[model samples]
Target chain A: MIEGRRAALPPVARLGDAALRLVGEAGAMFLFFLEAFGRIFRSWGQFHKTVRQIYFIGVKSISVITLISLFTGMVIGLQMYYALAKFGADGFLGAAVSLSLVRELGPVLTAIMITGRAGSSMTAEIGVMRISEQVDALRVMDINPLGFLVSPKLAASIICFPILTAFFDLVGMLGGYLTGVLLLGGNSGVYWYRVSAYLKMSDISGGFIKSLVFGVVVCTICCYMGYFTHMRRDSVGPEAVSQATTSAVVTSCVLILLSDYILTSLLF
Target chain B: MQANTPPDIILEGLTIGYGEHAVVSGIDAVLPGGKISVILGGSGCGKSTLVKHILKLHPVLAGRIVVGGHDIDTLDRRGMHCLRQRMGVLFQDGALLGSLTLGDNVALPLREHTRLPEKDIRERVLSKLGLVGLADFYDYYPNELSGGMRKRAGLARGMVMDPQLLFCDEPTSGLDPVTAAELDQLLLELKKSFEMTMVVVSHDLDSMRAIADHVLVLGAGRVLFQGGLAELEATQDEYLRRFLDRKAQERSTPRLTMPPLDQKMMKRDCGKYLDE
Candidate 1:
């Protein structure tokens, strides 16, 4: 009734297992590419559905971050004004708030949000595919497993992250307006003008490009972790899938941070 | 094909495996064309591995794999795809993609390998599903289907391409006895109608005996026996006698124990492991 752990295989069954042996070198590579291309092509129609998925996973996940980022901007504005006015320089509040949010805070905060919520689910979804043999089934049918599983999610993230970041930037700026007018007794026009004036095309594009690259890294690492799921002969179960999901998010976030630094350095 | 067509499978010393662990090697068996040749052996006998290589799912590490006139190991990418497009495989777990509806699952091969219009694909998918007696379950996902239905759906997918050679791994492994018998009968019917070359990897004697025209019995790492089914049943070798009767005779012994490992038995295991 309470068997803790069962054995992997009985000896008799192991003695007679027959699997077809792969013989050619080039044939294997060709098969691999064929699968990748097939998966990619078959996923084009599913792309829109994937965008819809992003709308669900990314856009819908934006609400909490929206509240947090707004409050964060307000808090930053109030704090900066208090510190600067001590030196009789509180008027720099607009430039200080705008510069920080545009160049850094808006993108950083949004990235963290997506990475925690949408990013983990994307990994988990793909991880489930890997463990469930959905990937292998694709391979079996001569379809590329990666393209079907990864392309849609990657493409969706590429589209969603920028839009989400823009939303973050917009909301955070509004928070600044509230802090300047309602909380700090300053002109709303000055806050709005200072924020827009400090913004550049590079700031916008850099964040977009960073988020795009982060999407690929997250999906690829997540997909890869799941693909090698059978690494454990004894326990290639759903728990392996959970580990893959965890690894996918952790790896993607780390890669995003590292690459953001590199990308920023290069672009600026 | 008519009943006159000879069974044929060509594996010219076909060897396949991962790094340092050859699963199947030196396989020179010819499973006759247009007939079922069940590769019967104990578990881990490299039967499924051999079927995978023949299907070109795995790369051939050495030797030639000839199926339906093409040397599979030498085919280019397009050529390999062309070859696979014509061969159907039913995996043991009935490995249908969970995301796809049963209809879409069966239609997948046709859609990929052919530029058949969506309407035509639908018709063909439905027809194949019908063949497996799943005419009404087209929209159902794999999880919704019972075990037998899932296996039948897998069969439908494999058969959609109308492949010349069909490789099935353990078609009736976990199903109940009645379901297993029914599956065997269905396979026999499919073979009779399609005239397809079937290479089934299974241990079920009733299934194998019901459909297999030729039997390739593998043990250790060697082709312990390969020939007509009647001959395998007649084989006097201890291993053959033990293997064939082991399951059927389970009630007689009540349990299976290690049968005194000797140098010869150890050599057999090594040979089986080194085979491909």
Candidate 2:
């Protein structure tokens, strides 16, 4: 009888229902993020947990971030050198590579990389804790699970994202120098001059702002996915954790790009 | 920091389930203070659901639950936390944090709730672990411990706060007989030593017989019996008799009604791989 009723519903109704659910989930996610973020200052003791998370989410991610950033910079340098060489404006290679990295690729790629590396783990760890009842144990012990588990991650992400973006931008400029000046035999002085002269405080600050927003977006979506793993209707237990982790990574990456566009439009 | 007597839990017309669908309803019972009240049932009879409702892990679906004279529903967030500080729960399979050592896991409650020095916290943690015979394995992670040890560690963490009320969900569900019996003994020891109100949710008849001071038997979404353990054991109700005696109900139909699978439908057949 229930199946028949559900089947009898019109496609438009079904679509509306799905749309409503999406809106509801967005509202809930916002509230969840607010509660967790607000609790970052709930206690002096949370300082230690935040620092530990920084070691895990920030310091541990440094090596991967470095590797990816260097390669990303190198690729940009090579591409820009060739593109500028066609127009005999290869002197602008540094400006092209540095601006693109700082304004776009640096924040976007760094976020995507961290989402794969750290954000996915955040989801899995919390999802496991959720399924295993460790989160409930915290609540029963009079400890808020949000304050204990997620606020630290959020704090660490906010701190790490911009710093990592800055690092990526700098390394990418050097990569441009490696290709444009050394490999392709362009004048090093002109390339360096273009990079320093074209880059402005507004561009740097805009990129910083983008990274910060991406940090909140990634952390919020990933943590929310894990925290609600048990409540997922499609699966249960370990499979649910896996699904949540996948969803966290996918959602964080998508949102990073989506928010990057929105922030770019607004900031620039 | 122990209460002179752990407070009684009062459940009035309580209905519990995941959502609108009710698993158990109209449950009215008073779990007395300073006694081990075991909630007995068959598998999936909403024993754990009731316990979760009482713990405020899930919202009360329909009725009122009063813990120590305070209606749990009326308590604000701060009030709820204050109420929860007086209670502890041991989940099935321990639920110890994977990231922390057993010692740190046990010390979590104290470190979060109290301003005690590290030395005092360590001393208290060691004492609790000692009570559970896990003092020597303080540095071990939860995965490194056996099932019984993890449960014992969970118990130690539950007790570290010296909570007035402790809830243990299936403390003896998945354990060897010897280990199960040892846990039962530990519960008895804790009851005798601390005099805290302990609500144990389990289907293990032996564990109930060994440790239950008061018994509440739930079946078919209602409280079938609520009283002394002897009274429950003495009851002659048909369902109760079948449950207590571990007798299977006589079925009117054959247990297996489905036809066997057709081997000819297989996408890949390799009859030579097996001896028919």
Winning candidate number (TM-score): 2
| DockQ per candidate, 2 decimals | 0.33, 0.86
* Tens-digit lDDT track of model 1 for B32-121: 888889999988888877876676656777788776666766677887666666668888877887767998889877765688899999
Evaluated on chain A only, model 1 obtains a TM-score of 0.76
What is the iRMSD in Å for candidate 2? Answer: 0.8
Ten contiguous residues with the weakest lDDT in model 2 chain B: B267-276
TM-score of 1: 0.81
Model 1 lDDT at residue A11: 54
DockQ of model 2 vs. true complex = 0.86
- Candidates' TM-scores? 0.81, 0.95
Error of 1 at A7 (Å): 27
- What tens-digit string does per-residue lDDT give for candidate 2 at A1-268? 4447656889998788779989999999999999999999999888999899889888898888888888887888888888888998888987898889989999999899889989999999999999998998898898899999999999999999998889888887887787778888989899888988999899999999999999999999999999999988778999999999999999888888889889999998
Native contact fraction (fnat) of model 2: 0.97
Model 2 TM? 0.95
The runs of at least 3 residues in candidate 1 whose Cα sits more than 4 Å from the true structure, single-residue gaps closed, are A1-60, A64-68, A71-75, A178-186, A231-237, B1-7, B247-276
